[model samples]
Target: MDMSIVLQAGVATGTALLFATLGELLAERSGIMNLGVEGMMLLGAMAAYWVSAHYGVPWMGVIIGMLAAGLISQIHAFITINLRADQVVSGLSLNFLAAGVSVVLGEGLNSIKGVAILPSFTIPLLSQIPWIGKIFFTNQGILVYIGYLVFPLVWYFINRTRQGLHLRAVGEFPAAADSLGINVYRMRYLYVFIGGLFAGLAGAAISLSISPGWFSEKTTSGEGWIAVGLVIFAQWNPIRAAFGAYIFGALRRLVLDIQGPMMILGLANPFYYNPYFGFFLQMLPYAFTIIVLVLGSREAIKKRIGTPAALGIPYIRGERGM
Candidate 1:
């Protein structure tokens, strides 16, 4: 396979992961762990595709899709934040709920044809900068470019601003933040909502930009889960998250491309002849995801690392300490 082609495709596919990872990262930063990212993505993809198919307006479809996912996220927020439910259980339940809703509502989406897709374009000066340009700046969807801007902006927002400091304070010490009158409950709800919006955007990116369709459960596949894993591997750092996302994206592209009937370096391609081997290859990314999630979870507990101290815990208004 052409390496540049693989990298180019990786960037495109990885954009969806970038969005999802950032969303989950933000929620986690605000002391909430949302495991319903996959469900939210699926719902967003279905809504975006369904809308675009009917109205011929991909942009509006994106808006409606994001809103749908964001609204559903409030369910998890209400249960975990308001009722003080187990965050993990609540998040997982939200996933099932959103997935069921998406499947039911998306019943006829895949059958629609001639839907309008989001636009793609090559940057003139930027697309000429050697390998980097070809992989990132050439004929990419508008959302891909947006991901590039969002990465640094999010990093800045998390680490370099007054609001970011408040976010960190609430996540690290909700009681302390509340003492300072920062409105801990309000902050968590807002970030969780923001997380859902990002997840929805990821879904819209897939149906309207990246893959350009609604494929039921297969639409998002398991990218949402992968994004969660990425956040763990990233240790709650946006820079690390972006790096991991792009690398995983490339690996995903490599898995599919290697199955083609072409020589590998100078030898024959085993996966080309033995198509069944593609299944194992396809599992590599997810296997890596599981490994990362398990190991990262252990490391976070042992080392504190970049983890928010209050993550996954419910905050009572008068509790003075964690």
Candidate 2:
């Protein structure tokens, strides 16, 4: 029960959630509900592995991975935003599409094995601090620290910038925003693309950073869904989402890392020692996701601060009524 190990592992896990959550947050803020995040992440993961294996540069894989996922997400954008298809169905379809395509591409790419992991860089001077250094700096990747920067910048963009104000206005009231000379459709497309970029990056973070290898296996393990839930749980706040990611990250890590150690020492909980508990343990993160979502719903309603008013409703532009 070393706290530092938990902190380090938890933050590593949180980094993935943070990226996916922020991506979804951007899309939702602009009135688009992109459920294809899981698909996008998977595609990115596969692509990251292939490119990293071929080119021998994790950074190139990251760039290509984002492009691949972002491109896939744009199809959802076109279907939902342009053709006005049902957003949910389109996103779900995108997920299946990615799964199928990944299976196909993965067949050939699976031969390219054991890609190198992105290097982890420890910050100088800061790494010398006793507890803070170990928990925050030691063995942490650059992307984890990048999440710290992204959180505040996103907070400012969403809450303080004029364009973000317009984006919010578009999500909450497209008709009014249209009346005020804002292009509703454009805003939705913009945010959706931004969301896709982050989702792709999330997937790349998985293959390139965490596990450091490629497999046809479902690498994300329903993280995209948890990310979706996290948006609701955090009431769409980047800062809050960041906090929730780490806490839940710790919970998932506890399930994976602690169970075997505890059982070997005969100090395990009954639940942990159960023969059938392995699958259930995997559900810990999602279960906590559901709980947080339910808990947040009350606060969201109480403060009148949850959800955009016009989210998921496509704007027909100059048509009467919603």
Q: Write the per-residue lDDT of candidate 1 for residues 1-322, one digit (tens) a residue.
A: 7899999999999999999999999999999999999999999999999999999999999999999999999999999999999999999999999999999999988888899999999999999999999999999999999999999999999999999999999999888888888999999999999999999999999999999988899999999999998998999999889998888888899999988756898998999989999999999999989887888788888986877999999999876665
By TM-score, how accurate is candidate 1?
0.97
By TM-score, who's the top model here?
1
Error at 224, model 1, angstroms: 0.7
How far off is residue 303 in model 1, in Å?
5.3
lDDT (Cα, tens digit) per residue for candidate 2, span 78-180: 9998899898999999989986787678676656666776888888888889997987788888788888799899999999999989988998889899999
List candidate 1 stretches off by more than 4 Å.
Answer: 294-303
Q: Which ten residues in a row have the lowest lDDT in candidate 1?
A: 313-322
How many clashes in each structure?
Answer: 0, 0
Q: What TM-score, to 2 decimals, does candidate 2 have? A: 0.93
